[model samples]
Target: MSPALVNNSVISDMNTQENSEQRYRLLIYNYLSHKTTAEEKEVLLDWLKQSEENRKLFSDYKKIFDLTVSSDQKSRFSYRKPEALKRLKSKIDPSVSDARRLKIKRLKYYLQTAAAAILIFLIGALTSFWISRNQSVQNLSITKYEVIAPRGGKSEVVLPDGSKVWLNAGSNFRYGADYGINNRDVYLEGEGYFSVMKNPANPFVVNTSGLEIKAFGTSFNVKAYPEEKFVITTLVEGTVKIEGKGLNLSLKPKEVVVLSKESYEIKPDVDKVTTTSQLSERTGRDRSEKKEDISFSKSVQVKSNVNTNIYTSWKDNYWIIESESLRNIASILERKFDVTIRILSPELNQYTFTGTFYKETLEQILDILKLTAPLGYEIKEGIVVIKGEQKRKSIYDNFKTN
Candidate 1:
């Protein structure tokens, strides 16, 4: 064949194919709108039967048709493409500024607009779908969330698994998005009162500095401050499994466990291991050596049938103290009132008191304590200075001796 004849034939075939594509597109639109004549419908049906690709293409157009037009649009056909498409575009892809993408002229004026609306809406929908997918992927990489209750105030938080936590003053609590899914674990620093929701399969675990309190269905209180010498776990209702270094205890209802922070360790030259309290009692030991020899305590003391209110009452309006030391109570008062306490008289730390205080001011509480013992307090710029009244204390001491 001649080269010129071959080129002419190829051009004719390209024009015919382009015309065929436009015709088929128009016919499909007419069929969807119910405006196709009997002859046009026959032509479309024959074309659909010609190839599986043709049928697939028609099916794809049908999906766009169904989404853009209402189901019952035969009798009162209302075109809602303009407003609905604008709303979808603004909400999903307002930043899309490509004018060429929106200039699609598939059908006549109304059809043209409808086609553009459908295309833009699809792009927006797919874009939002991908953005949401990326967001969920990013969330999986993140770890946990920390919630804090600063000094002088308490906070009540509801966990993702429907468990309730009452964080005491100067407390920190943390959990993650996978809290209720993979595992129900929470990290607590300082004191917290937990009312856990029961899930037999996914047990709730409280991770403190020195202990892990696991509960299947229970309510409990944990006090594990770093500066304190002890980590106290009090069980109110249900059972809890407490685990620490060389200590594993299952607490029953109305029971309390105290784990001392001072571990038993042997001095460098000494053969026998002694408790931290015993080491502190040593007469001639250097202060630096004592610190170096101390380790995390494994001492666990469990008391059954104990008063749980005394330990957990800080959450309530009234605080109950049952023979608690004044030195220990100073820390509680500092956290409760958001103040610094300076106990100048070292002897006053040994003073123990048992009482219940309800809505008492700091000064009022101090006054009440003064009435009970030879104790004097002075408040200066949010700091409370506690000192012993030597004269009165001496008189009381003489009276006791007599």
Candidate 2:
């Protein structure tokens, strides 16, 4: 099969960046099969030199090529030719005899090149790399697969077990090589929405910052950005168990749990202080009368009867914000639009807004916001500076006093 036949759908579904990625992938495939032209080899070499990430990705593909297209595999493909060739040719359309002939010629070409095109498709990045037929991936050194959504864009990833994950901007999701074969656990940073495949025996776990969300089969959204003070888990459908240090909670559909990071950070200090208080009480120092002001504790709040869409809607094109403060909204807009936002006026942070944005540009959203409040904004060099309209602020302040 031609590389175009294998990557046509992939190129169509992805963005321009992904289309370029597919082109390079084909180049890599051609290069490994020893069919690269002089120009294609230079292009691949230049891409490899661009970054460590590109080099690492190319290295992974090279490893896959070495494993799949070895001398023994070549001999086997050469020996078991009749059945496989017949099965491949059967898929060709009877009406397009010329096309069928062309495909058959391509198949023969692949045989001459010592690599199978269908094998390339099967071992592509979209699917899990099956190292060997006789052994499990667990028996081999684990190869970690990482998918990162850039700061300005979101990414969709399909796991080995058909579990789909939509990562928000500036997010990273990863899993081990033995993902579907032996385990179904994934690590997440930033935020991701998961629509997991139903596997009752094998549980799916999303590991965040010191927190583990275990689900048998469920759809849920996890927001665990490092800058944020809380790790939020919102269950959309089915049930999920949230577990961590001094925290274990089960969430039902439409329920959201917010775990404070301060609680996790102060556990050791809290334990020490508690121990000291107990010792003081045992020593008869009258410490019971002197109350220690320690504000840290295991702060886990589970809110019921909530609109889960408010939390999970970020993954979609239209984002719905409900009574969110300007300060918080700025952060969301920054991630969504991939811009730097700065709030100049402290009073603007006090104002809250509620709106549904439908793929609006940064300027359009800002225009709508200006009508709701005495807000002024300036954009230069991709940085947005938001301030209060001084004249309007004065009128608003007077109106508030009255």
Residue 236, model 1: lDDT of 82
What is the clash tally of candidate 2?
0
Candidate 1 clash pair list: none
| CA RMSD of all predictions | 31.9, 27.0
- Native-vs-model 1 lDDT? 0.68
Give the alpha-carbon lDDT of every model.
0.68, 0.70
Give a tens-digit lDDT track for model 2, residues 1-402.
Answer: 354544444234546786878777776877888766666667678889999999998988888878886453355355436534544565565443333321211011111111223221111334343334454544576666666665666766666555677788778777777787767989999999898878999999999998889998888999999888778899877889988776667777877776767777664433322333222121224422221212234355555657776787666665888888999899977776667999999989989999888767778889899988999899886789999999998898899999
Query: In candidate 1, which residue ranges exceed 4 Å CA deviation?
Result: 1-139, 264-298
Q: Best by TM-score, which number?
A: 2
